[model samples]
Target: MSLGDDHGYGDSARTDASGEYGGTGTTRTRLPESGPYGGARRGRSSSRSLVTVVGVVVLLIAAIAFANRGDGDSGGAPDTADKPDTAPTAASGTDPVKSSTAGVPTGYSQSEQGAQSAATNYAVALGSTGMFRKADRHALLDALFTRDAAARLKGPMDQAYSTGFLDSMGLDENGDPPEGSTFVSRVSPMGTTVEEYTDTTAKVAVWYVGLIGMSGERSTDPVTSTWKTWTFDLSWTDGDWKIVEDAQTDGPAPVPGDDRAATSDEISKAIEEYGGFTYAR
Candidate 1:
């Protein structure tokens, strides 16, 4: 599927792997100017207002559900929720190659399962805090994408995380978090599905929850979670599956739970103490 079909907030669309950067009359995925989810940052007032409205709507729905629970209407459809059918612990019957390039898992087998693995891992990399830093972002692009795609994206990606953008997010010119603040940007894949597969090309969708923003006592943008589905078009290139193009959508988000939000210090400590894993099916 073409990446440009949708352009919602936090969405990105890129040219195909074979397309040249500004030479083949093709468009590249434009990263947003602000926000940790790769979108133009919203004003605090607007964001807070939207959140309040959504919270009220959710509470009203819950209250209505509770009031109607005993009305004897038990024929409602099941909540499929667009989640994966299999459990996370179930084996996929594939042994992933324990190889990596520049800290990203690599050497995936040329199969549908391998494509799913690669897509999910690449999603994590693309949504990472490293993407906010120039050097680390360049390294990740080089490692996770085709050579042409990496070269094509460097300029635009750099602009997206420009100095002005960093300052807007309270980061320094070097994209470092402010002292006493911990910047958070992490992607946790809930599941993956292969949309279409061929011998040399595969398209996979990764449903994930991402945590982003800064954690600190004086932070204006406290860490928040977002749900999104990242669709990757991958090609088996140079002995590994590399990203060709990709797109993202809001989500098939589940109902919000009643868990309390953690403190900034708690979030900072947890981020430092917990290590991420190399996801393999």
Candidate 2:
């Protein structure tokens, strides 16, 4: 499964995602520039109006570019990585994958189990709320993505968290609470497997789900769920599956059940009142 196949907004196609920078549509019209002396005045007015439109377009382009800059990269379906220098030398490199509930990884490794462990754990971290905060986002990319990719991602990711994005989700321009609303964005890994592996690199597939959107009465689209498979093209840069690139797309999704959806208030309270988990497998 490719990373683009993910289920949440992170998913390339199947998920419902909107970044703060760009409004959902992309169509645009050009402004009139010819002078209107008789038509001169008319022309000037048209030009000014068009100029204003151009300005909005420029801002939109910049915003979308910034907001959508994330880790998912492409290099075809995951293939095996380069060979390691030493023969499985008594299980070296980083500590074992740490766990919180049962599937989360605190820190993981490169062994078979370790690969799966790392993928699952990393998925949770990559999909969590931390990816939105500057300090937390930095901590996560450094901890999860490949060093080079992480460096490229830092600034763009920050810009993507624009005030407009917050407003779209019914959040304050800073993604903080408005006294009553709660923001909900989370990921939970279900299973994992090493799609590609070698001593120097490993491609791990993490199948999981995510919950997103505003959590209050004001939200038009309340929280929703999606399933996706995120494939990581990791290089053993330092140690671990330091993601060089990744991609996402829709499920492997199961058909929907006939269950009643939660109320906006219920969802809000759950998000505001509840906390997320620390995973390990």
Candidate 3:
């Protein structure tokens, strides 16, 4: 069966016809009423990642649960009292940091521009396929989050991305798809805006488009794209911006396009050839 959303860790529900991992499940399961992620099931048309902030990241929906821990500024955020209604589209000309930590961009300036850059990069990292794997996920958390936040989340996040969950998404214990299939999960940032800013803390929102699903002739889950707004509450810590906590919501998505879907081979080739960029203000 095919899953939806590009958050990549996997979140779709369907009872298997043959009671196997990749079985042809005809009986569609439904999400629980208690919470958004509890047994949650979403249609193909759902606009964004399926996770909620209250608790539990059941698949593509991961809300890092670092509550009230970051942001030392006590002045309180004003309701855009002195800020512009919208940010300009022009480039800031300041170059992005050339250094990297655990393959993530690092060394951001302690400014509004730096916060935006941190948020954008963090969004991409969180929405990637690596979040599905054990070692990679830990490394990513280390690079993207504050020390305390990452330590608190590692155990819970591990539980959320369990072996059963991986099987449901047609991925092995290593977070790999079938032998011949290519699992595609990527996030491309559209733009960013600062919701609130301070010397020690900042809230930034990133509008992005994501691709998820498996690409192969034998694959049932062909790659599909979705739009989302991922907002991060960042704290300037350890010489750079680090995530305290984050949440995601459905877009501000534009109208659907009329273009035809590309083949699995084509999609695989394109992904292999076209590398992503290091985003900055």
Candidate 4:
């Protein structure tokens, strides 16, 4: 996926696939009131029913008693002797970066958690409204990318955010929406993964849902959502993680839900009122 496909941040020539971001009835069987098996079978069935009811009651009582036990004072805690040493997954409990460079998060730790955090934050920055503006976009790239990468990408990135491209998205040549219209290009990362990592370099992926387009009564390009996975190759340099390369792929998008599309007014109001998050793994 190109950045333009989600945020209008990349070359518009590379249009990605716009695929359609592609119940139980219970029945009860009743026992026969009468059958050829006779009254003896009926008596046995009644006994079995009584036994099942009694067993259920006993189990319920036992469960309640177990739940009410003391917390290991009298050896009443649940048996955890065979529990595994490591958790299958867990959070690192690190707070997101409180400081940023040119509005991009910086100063991540040297751990896997930090790598994931950096990747997620980079995805958000690369997919933000600032990326559509020349000066702000250059600043963002300089702050988030390594020096070499930024130099190599400067010309291409400028070309990608061209005036013609901005015009196609209902924006003026400067990447600003017309008066009374709101241009929305925001990325919210759902989760992050460190696909590969080392002390000096790491490859991370962030799965995210993005909102893009112009929101206004007169807007032809209404705001819409796209799901994508953004992967970044990062290097630990100058005591911070900086992106060396970045790429995006069309999602593992979920089936569309039944919710009605919100009105332009509602969309504009929501964007204005709700702030974005400082994401962490």
Candidate 5:
């Protein structure tokens, strides 16, 4: 295929239909929610990388549990005040961190510690490798966010995963690489602060850096980029850090440093070799 073969999602579906996640070949499974599921799902961004912060709807949807995310530096935040110029990571938790993730709270609590833990974990889930998989997308969405928001967000996501977009990353149709590539997408939370909170309503921001691209392959966009600190104005909803509405501006972006780029083999191996974690505030 030529470099600019217009593989954009506007083109036809090239379902690799293979039996892998990040490997070559398209694959589709008949979920219980199958049939005519796709046509309606076409409008969402369809991005398999870290889901981009799409819009403001996330604000209302994620407001259920912000009450306990702890307040800002002085202990609580006034949602309307001019926020800090920038937020750095936090010190260790002074409060307890308990989370009952899915039936099992898993020790998640509702204090500054709890909020931090929740934010960290949610950020990881929100910024995971699963965002790319069609089969796993809904589950991750349902798990981390409110159902209402998930419903509306899905279609836009599908569209975002257009063929041209995937090709741009040197992948075939299903957001995967040939035999020797590693598509890497990860989000590391530098720290988080609850800008505002009131019982069932709260606003939290997670500042982070994400890594996206084919680590080592025939890719022009190496699996390397340093975006500005990403902030999520998340809400506490349906028992999780559901991002109701969020926005991002450029960095506390660090100056370009002297870290050597990993070789394609190193990147691919690392992608497969390294495991991801569920972050908490």
Candidate 6:
């Protein structure tokens, strides 16, 4: 797994110990070898959209099933014509932690909600601008992953974020953008689901949208949006959840809205002004 800027987004076509992001219909098993930005090579953008639609349908069915078993009572008959607005069915009444370890959220509960929280927070951290730097990246992985997983991933990850990759992103050897340039790479979790759960282990999938690129007049790689589902296999270790394994797949994206894309300056300013959240489910 590489800590490079191009690691998490599904734009790549290659896979490694680091997670892979697939396109709409096809699975991207690895990072792209084409260039530093991993420009989209898949000719099937429409097919990828269809796959996202199908994935959404599957998630809806699962959500319905889960809702039916709430409070130990069978949910009432389905009302297709008068379906309620989409919203979270269960609320744990728990607030997110106000503290963090090395800028990563901690203190998750031992329930499914906690698992989802851990996955979403981890997604954000893994997708941040900090991943481009070796020192920050190492600290992040150490904080989020189990000791064994971190140890196994360190070497491959270091290799992935080699000098060549950083140079490709127009960053200096230290992974810093040129003066007056802002490198933006951030992940925003839209929703989360618990795929599997037990007392000690949990599998959670975070549906998120990410922004990646350098925002500056001299920048060759411009910021762009990507939708993906990041699945994390977590262990309840010590007093917090830690990742043992993780993977990314193409999105469960909804149809695009009529919103216009923001300008580079606007994106850069927003990134600087806004702080990330400690997401809770």
lDDT of 5 by residue, 226-250 (tens): 4333334345565555544333433
After superposing candidate 6 on the true structure, give the runs of residues whose Cα lies further than 4 Å from its correct spot: 1-76, 79-91
Per-model TM-score versus the true fold: 0.75, 0.61, 0.72, 0.71, 0.60, 0.74
Clashes in each model (backbone N, CA, C under 3 Å)? Answer: 2, 28, 1, 0, 49, 8
Question: How well is each residue in 1-281 modelled by candidate 3, as lDDT tens digits?
Answer: 11123133223321222111112332121211111112222344433333232224443243333543467767677577786787667658898787888788999999999999888887777667787788998898788877766665666556556787777666799888898788887888899999999999998988987777778898876677777676778889989998876655667767554355799999999989998878889
**TM-score head-to-head 2 vs 4, winner:** 4
Tell me the tens digit of each residue's lDDT in model 6 across 1-281: 22222434224433334344322321122342433223342223345567678889999999998987667446676668876434394545687565688798888888888888888888888877776788987898789888766655555556656687778777787889999999887788888888889989998888877777789887787886666677888899978898877766666656554355687788889989998887888
Q: How high is the lDDT of residue 30 in model 3?
A: 20
Candidate 1 global lDDT: 0.71
Cα error of candidate 2 at position 269, Å: 4.1
lDDT of each: 0.71, 0.52, 0.66, 0.65, 0.47, 0.69
State the lDDT at 215 in candidate 3.
Answer: 88
Better of 2 and 3 by TM-score: 3
The list of candidate 4 runs beyond 4 A from truth reads: 6-91
Candidate ordering by lDDT (highest first):
1, 6, 3, 4, 2, 5
Of candidate 2, the 10-residue stretch with the lowest lDDT total is: 29-38
Give the best candidate by TM-score. 1
Runs in model 1 deviating more than 4 A are: 1-30, 38-93
Could you arrange the candidates by TM-score from highest to lowest? Answer: 1, 6, 3, 4, 2, 5
Highest lDDT among the candidates is held by which one? 1
Q: Looking at model 6, which ten-residue stretch has the lowest summed lDDT?
A: 21-30
**Which tens-of-lDDT digit does each residue in 75-158 have in candidate 4?**
656688987543224456678576889977788888778888888888778677886788887898688877766655556556
Local accuracy of candidate 1 as per-residue lDDT tens digits, 1-99: 111112111233233332212223222344543466643223333355677799899999999989877756577766889876653544476766678
